[model samples]
Every structure is written in C-alpha cells, then in structure tokens.
Target: MSKTDFPRRENFCEFILIRSVGNDSYLGNIWSDEAKFTKNGLFKRHNSHYWSNTNPHVFRERNFQESWQFNVYCAIRTDRVVALEFYQENSNSKL
Candidate 1:
C-alpha cells in the first residue's frame, strides 16, 4: 500500500492465521505465539517422468502420488506474519 492509502496517522494491522483439516477448520493468532516455519521450496519446473527418445518404458500405475499445494501470504505492512506451521494432512489451501 502507498502513503495515500492510510486512513489515519497511526494504524494497527492485525495478522491472522488459519488452518483446515478437510471439512473441519481452525483459526488462531500468529503474533503472540513464537511460531517456527519451514522454508518454502524453490520455484522451478517439476516433472515426475523423464522424457527419452532412445528408451522405451513400460506402463504401470499412472497415479504416482497425490500432490497438494499450500501458501501463506501476508499483507503489505510492517507487522506481518513472518512464519507459519503447515501440517501435511491438515493444511489451509487458501488464505
């Protein structure tokens, strides 16, 4: 946000954290707790099966693995959420 977007001279922007386990969900505060986070993976093209011209591969089960994505995005502010905890089984797909 720019300086002109500020509504007042002093403002407080609170951070929010949320988690979901399939149908169930949970919401909590991230500022008060000393939260630790794992670094996100690098951005690059990912291919499970390699392409080859000289070799012929046999077909097996097409479903190699189940892939799920997760991300944590904070607003543009000084007091922002720096870290987060993400459980594989129960993770929030969106903010």
Candidate 2:
C-alpha cells in the first residue's frame, strides 16, 4: 500500500466506526452486490384455473419472466429515517 492511500482508508474506517456506534441498524443498508427484488404482476398466481400446465420446464421459466424486480436504497437512523431514495430503473449507484 502507498502512503498516499492511508488517509482515504483511514477516513473510510473511521466513517464505519462512527456510523456503527450503538446502532446495528447499519446492517439494514443495502449493498451494491446484494440482490434486490420488486413486485410485478407477472408470475403471480392471480387465477387458480386460468392456465393449464403442459411442459413443467417451460411453465417454470415463464413464471420467472412474468415476475417483477427492482432495487431500492434507504437508511434508518436510531429513531428516525435519515435517508430514503428510490432509484430509476437505470440508476447504477454503488457503495
């Protein structure tokens, strides 16, 4: 590691320690690499007998395609919400 990198790393570790004080609430924060889910009216079983199953494999795949998914970023402090952000479908922010 270079000496120049020490300040940046030190700042990050300091930030984590400060944020973590008395609050495990940091664990609720969503990370970039984690998977996110959104609700979409696709694979859900709305009707019981509306569809017939022919090939189980194809049906299984169609179910997946019909489901909905999305990502959200939010932060909750001790007794108050510090941040709540809903990103666009194309937003790619990471931390």
Candidate 3:
C-alpha cells in the first residue's frame, strides 16, 4: 500500500480505555480532555466522548479513581469516525 492509503498522523486521535472494577473486562472509548486520564488515557483525542454510552458528566475522574480500574488505547481518525457514524450509516441503514 502507498502512503496515501494510510491516514495522516494529524488525522489520528487518542481514545479512552476503561477497565471495569473487580473484573478483567475492559472498554475502549472516545477521548475527552476533561477526564484528564494521563496514565489511563489512550492515543485517540480532542473532545470526543470518553465512553460508549455513559454520560461524560457521570463517568468522571473522581468516580473512576474512587472505583479504580478506569481509562485509554490506540489511535483512530475522527474523520473516519464521522464518515462511518454519519455518511456510512445513512447509506447502510435508517436506524
């Protein structure tokens, strides 16, 4: 594949990883700076939601640190995410 086939580094963003308390289960979600997940945070980035379904206001650092095993992962492109969530979905299904 050519360099053109790869997404530019600037397009890449940080993601969040959430580890469930008292269990081995883990979750990777969108990134949010407000969470301040320095150790737990992933490379995914810039204002995205921290978790899949959990509200940002609720799934915060205080609660997470209290419970522990929280937060991050690898890189993902926001542009691709938008394309899949909006453009691709419109073509794929009505939902």
RMSD per model, one decimal:
15.2, 16.0, 18.0
Q: Which ten residues in a row have the lowest lDDT in candidate 2?
A: 41-50
Give the higher-lDDT candidate: 1 or 3.
1
Residues forming the 10-long window of minimal summed lDDT in candidate 1 = 12-21
Per-residue CA lDDT of candidate 3, range 1-95, in tens?
Answer: 35864565434422122233443333333433212233444323455556665565654443345332323223334233312221211122333
Winning model by TM-score: 2
TM-score of 1: 0.18
Candidate 2: lDDT of 74?
Answer: 68
Q: After superposition, how far is residue 7 of candidate 1 from its true place, in Å?
A: 36
Better of 1 and 2 by TM-score: 2
lDDT of each: 0.37, 0.56, 0.34
The TM-scores of all predictions, comma-separated, are 0.18, 0.30, 0.16
Q: Give per-residue lDDT, candidate 2, residue 71.
A: 51
TM accuracy, model 2: 0.30
Which residue pairs show collisions in model 3?
13-43, 13-44, 14-43, 14-44, 14-45, 15-44, 16-72, 17-71, 17-72, 42-73
Give candidate 3 misplaced runs (Cα > 4 Å).
1-6, 10-37, 42-45, 48-57, 61-95
Distance from true position, residue 45, model 2, in Å?
27
lDDT of 2: 0.56
